[model samples]
Target: MDTQHDIALTRALAEVPGPLPVSGVIHVAVPHASRFTVVGNHLAQHAELSLTAIGIGVYIQSLPAGSQVGIKALAARFAEGETTIAAALRELETHDYLHRTRERLANGRMVTRTVFCNQPGALLRGGAVAPVTVASVPRPVVTPVVPAPVVAPEPTPVPEEGPPPVRLPSRIAPKPPRRPLPQPREPTPELHRAASALLADLRRHAPELVLSEGDVEELVPGAAAWLERGAHPDAVRHALTTELPQPPKYPAKIVRHRLTVLLPPPLPGAQELTAAPRTPVTPFQTCEGCDRAFRSPAPGHCRDCRAQYWEAA
Candidate 1:
């Protein structure tokens, strides 16, 4: 619709052969132009400065010392959304209003540190201005422009309406990451000694329940498992060392089966475990070659004896 102001604007913009003189003054504060903090109005509200960016900046600056807030919290506080906030924050980062830095705490945890700036295009490191950082200003991230609805005088031909088409992304499920394969374990002499010692301890209580080398190896793990579950060694000895049934033909087999089937449960509490006087155990296995005691087993030889035997071999 044609209006008086529209007609005047049209006439003013029209190209003519001869020039019609027109001039105007834009009043600006000289003090604002001179001061570092007092930015020129156009500079203050540059194309990069969205309403969301300005609001985010204000919110950051207004936060109290030792206070921390997250992007989701900010979205909830402003009654906006995560996507909108993220886009605004991206804009802020590109324009150098802020940059996110990864910081490590004394406790060895990683945290994201947002450094805010009243002025754009400044170098920073974890909320502190870094004078050492050379200035190389980054370009701003462009926000998407949405076209306005066009109203027409006459009705246009509309396409036949149907249900919206299903997207490819919505149907497919993402696959989980594959795990790495397990590595084989190596055996040590102390592990062997432990199995032999456990069988030796069991023989002290029940002489008939004899275990072969292979049986000792298998039963050692079960005893170790019971110990790990907080059962006392004495309790395990009592539980497995039961009365012989008649002549006890296969006592060893019966004992091994009982040990396997009836593994001890974890100790109920600290007091139950501490009720009996518990002594710190220091394992001593004598070297067969040297007739000398050693803290750890070394194929029936002390470290010195073993080294000598290997060198001699």
Candidate 2:
């Protein structure tokens, strides 16, 4: 492999191993704009192919640790709009940056490993690109949007028939048309009753369970019907215990109270606990060939450095 190119690749990878934005292009420059121009030109031209080929590598580096790579997640990062996940994954295999491993998850979903690009591959080592021979690749997944259910209108009621021959005209003038009666409000007695009952039951059975205002709001729906029927407090309590079998238990009360009590008083300008003392490690001799230091005990110098030192001697 070309050492200079390898060095540049490593440097660029170090700079952009994380999920970086396009704005990070400035970090690629070493010091001066002139040196940056030379490096930038090379990357923009010769290194572009390799850098672009490692699209999945860039993606793998960006992912959270232990997270299984999914096609949806890959697509959102790499393809975005220009290409589909299926296409990018296919190309990735061609570049030898990723491989698929099949397994069954606990939920019985067919799981696959989207391998990292750290392992040596022919193309990655500047070898020729090989043809992909895999029989099956995951297709681009698009979730379909489901429309809401349609409700049909109720049929109109038919009018009763009247006798046509016996028409007794009692009124000398035409009578005014009668207006339609307004629909009665829907019955909410059941709702109020249920809410009231639930509240009462909580107070009686699970008195230890401290409920917040939000919790009460949520519980009210259960006893709404009872509340609407002018339910007495005692009747509401009885109805709640009888109707709802589950007692109101606040699982988080102990946790909340514990948290409140255990909270340490705020220490303004408090210093952190002193770290444990560290034992002295063996001294490392400086390399003669390079600036790197080695931790070998009784070492004269690094092998490479010693060789250079001897050559100069």
Candidate 3:
């Protein structure tokens, strides 16, 4: 091909996504002749015993030696009377060991190119600045590894069998005295509640016992978790002592379950309070105990008065 045609083919080859199959090139070069080489995706075609075969054989041989085959010119030369390039290509396709590709020109023309070897091989045409090579597919190359040497363990010295013997060595003195134990920390309110709950259990289940508040406090450390859950101490101790389906001795689970059981439906926000007050308060007749006035407080007395009145009544 001419230099202009060659440059055009180079640009076309570069435009291809990767190496072209020779078939791809042929498809691109269907109506136009171009000078190009294949980089990837081989062609499959048959070439009978003809000038085309000879030229292809020659072209294959000339590749590593660096020769350019103006593919269109070569096809014209080989595709003489009654013999078609397609037929020749069909024959060439019988060979399993060849790699081929097709490239397209700017005008959407194709040139089918081929190589004798498999992929990652190159095809160099004359006057081209760079040779076309298929990108290599990675393959793992396994190498045998030598194992490290085994180390022999040192033998432990064994004492000979004998009777018991005397003691020795007064040089090392005993360790110095440790400081006195730390003062105990006070139990938190939650711990106190939990302890009381457990003590309540003892009061019920183990009715014969009389444990002082201090004794209960001491035992609190062990059962304070139950008390914190608002459980009575006696019930907690009975459950623990009796191995009744006692809860897991963890405050988190206990409190969580307690809240889950005791939780009421959520109250509506102020936005939902659409009703007006039904019972308005009066200024006089305040309860003596609470001093808050109310209109006809329960039993005709205010909260404090009612408390005293209820106590007396």
CA lDDT scores, all candidates in order: 0.58, 0.47, 0.46
Ranking by lDDT: 1, 2, 3
TM-score, per-candidate, Cα-based: 0.27, 0.23, 0.17
Candidate 1 displacement at residue 77 in angstroms: 1.1
lDDT of 2 by residue, 1-313 (tens): 6999989877786786466566636445333321111112222243424544445445453443455455665556554543555565565566455566675656555546455443334335675433222233255333222111111122223446776678788777887564321111344665645554455456556455455666555445433433443445555454333433245355234323322232233333424555658988988876645767887777456777777778999
- Which model, 1 or 2, shows the larger TM-score? 1
Top lDDT prediction, candidate number: 1
lDDT tens digits by residue: candidate 1, 1-313:
5698888665655644355457763232222221122222433467767888766755554453334445666777887888888887787677776567676667555666665555443323433332322223344423222111111122223457799976676656778553321111333455446545866677678887776767776566656665566566687677778776766687566656666667655557867767777786767889898889888733477889989988999
Superposed on all Cα atoms, the candidates' RMSDs to the truth, in angstroms, are 29.1, 43.5, 29.7
Candidate 3 worst ten-residue window by lDDT: 145-154
Candidate 2 clash total?
Answer: 26
Where is the poorest 10-residue window by lDDT in model 1? Answer: 146-155
Candidate closest to the true structure, highest TM-score: 1
